[model samples]
Target: MEWLERMNRAIDYIEENLTGDIELSEAARMACCSSYHFQRMFSFITNVTLSEYIRRRRLTLAALELQHSGVAKVIDVALKYGYDSPVSFARAFHALHGITPAMARQDGIALKAYPRLSFLITIRGADAMNYRIETKESFEVFGIEGIFRTDGDGEAPQTPAKLWEQSHANGDVKQLEARAGVLPSFVSQDLYPVNAVCSYRKTGPDTFPYMLCAFKEENSNTDGYTTVTIPAYTWVIFPSEPHQWEQFGDTIETLYRRFYTEWLPTAGYEQVDGVEFEMNGTKNGLNYIELWFAVRKI
Candidate 1:
């Protein structure tokens, strides 16, 4: 199946199972992508977390059921939508629609509706997207790593910035740069920050490791840092225009949005399970970066 078709089918699956327990793994499976990639891509494309989307959807349906079915009790509606208790259901409902179930059922209450989502590819003017596909052998990256979670507003939290500050203050970045055997020219290059998942477990809060790293050999000295092995995989590289240090964050976020919504659907490749990295550097007095996404041909 095509990438678009698979994505739409995933949406269909979510709609069908909204009232039941939905697993991120199953949703990604329906979309033919890994859970990590699916969640990231879904958030980038829709600007909402997967859980938030599911919650809004369930609440929307629950509100309708409560308003229309005069005989249906609030507890029945809540349980039907997978809420364990009426209290929990009312809390979530009020949070989303700004009104409780009883208020919604009253004469003149307005309830917000989040209709089901369907995706379609629309063509605008053809603006060239600069990227290259390349396969590399396995490699290792050594650096300071920390865990960060996504905020409620769908923004990556400030934990990563705190990690970088700690690393810089303690001279860990310099230590890793001096130990670099490969990419020496860019070793001390403070531009690129590599982010990857050591392991993805499907329970609890969503979090992942973000690393400030450089290329290292297998026999690199064990010091005050950690190392992660990146297996061989094909990568799609998106290089950005030169920008100032302050603009780096916004630039990368824009690139991600473009990658998911504009590039991947037409790039003739599907994402694979592997590490993603950013290559940062400076040229002609302007800082630049490149995003690398692991993928395989569809």
Candidate 2:
């Protein structure tokens, strides 16, 4: 099935069963995909994580009912929305809407509502993406590494680029490059706790450490450099258009959106790993960009 259509079906299912128990795995099954792929694709396509979207929708419905319905107690409303206890429900509700349930009930407080979502795919950009599938054994990369947080979904923090920019500006880029052996990879976990994202940290005084790393197998001979050998795996390598120099963030976003919405489902492949990264090819007028995403056959 087309991914968008399957996503639409998933959305319908969530709306229909909003007041009942909903399983993440079951939702992916309904979409005819694996839980990992489904959740990743959902985040890529919608720019919102699956859990966040669900919570918003549930809270929206609950808040509307709280204001309009004759439900007497907030606990009843919370239970109806699948919360185990009023305290848990109240905390979540307040976090999302900026108002507690009792406060909403007492004075009929107005709250921000997360409306139901529908999937819609649109194409606007004219640039063609350059990408290919790669299969290789594990390798090592020597660079800097750090961890950062994603505020809501998988949003990129300002840290990564700032690190890169500072390195470039302070002439630390050349020093690191002298020690740079292989290109690096970005390692990430599929399921992260709420509001926390992995960050990047400098590896050494001269060399920035790469948390998620990648490199050719033959170049693992750097002095004082640790080796992180990745297992043999398949990857999707995307070459960015030459026109998007210094616009790494936007270019990557566009690529992910397309992969989630246009590729993947139709390509008959399922995502297997959270390991993703970019290869800094020789710069060409600030437009040469290539991104690599690790994947495996499903």
Error of 1 at 288 (Å): 1.2
Model 1 spans > 4 angstroms off: 145-162, 181-210, 218-220
**Best prediction by TM-score:** 1
Candidate 2 weakest ten by summed lDDT: 190-199
Q: Give the TM-score of each candidate.
A: 0.83, 0.60
Q: How many residue-pair clashes does candidate 2 contain?
A: 21
lDDT of 1: 0.75
TM-score of 1: 0.83
Residue 184 of model 2, lDDT score: 34
What is candidate 1's lDDT per residue for 1-298, written digit by digit as tens?
Answer: 3888988988998999988877767777888766666788899899988888899999999998888877789999999999999999999999999998988787667999998888778786788788888878877777777665534233434566666677778887667666664453423344533333333222223445567776676545647777777778888888888899899899888898899998888878887752577677786798887788888888
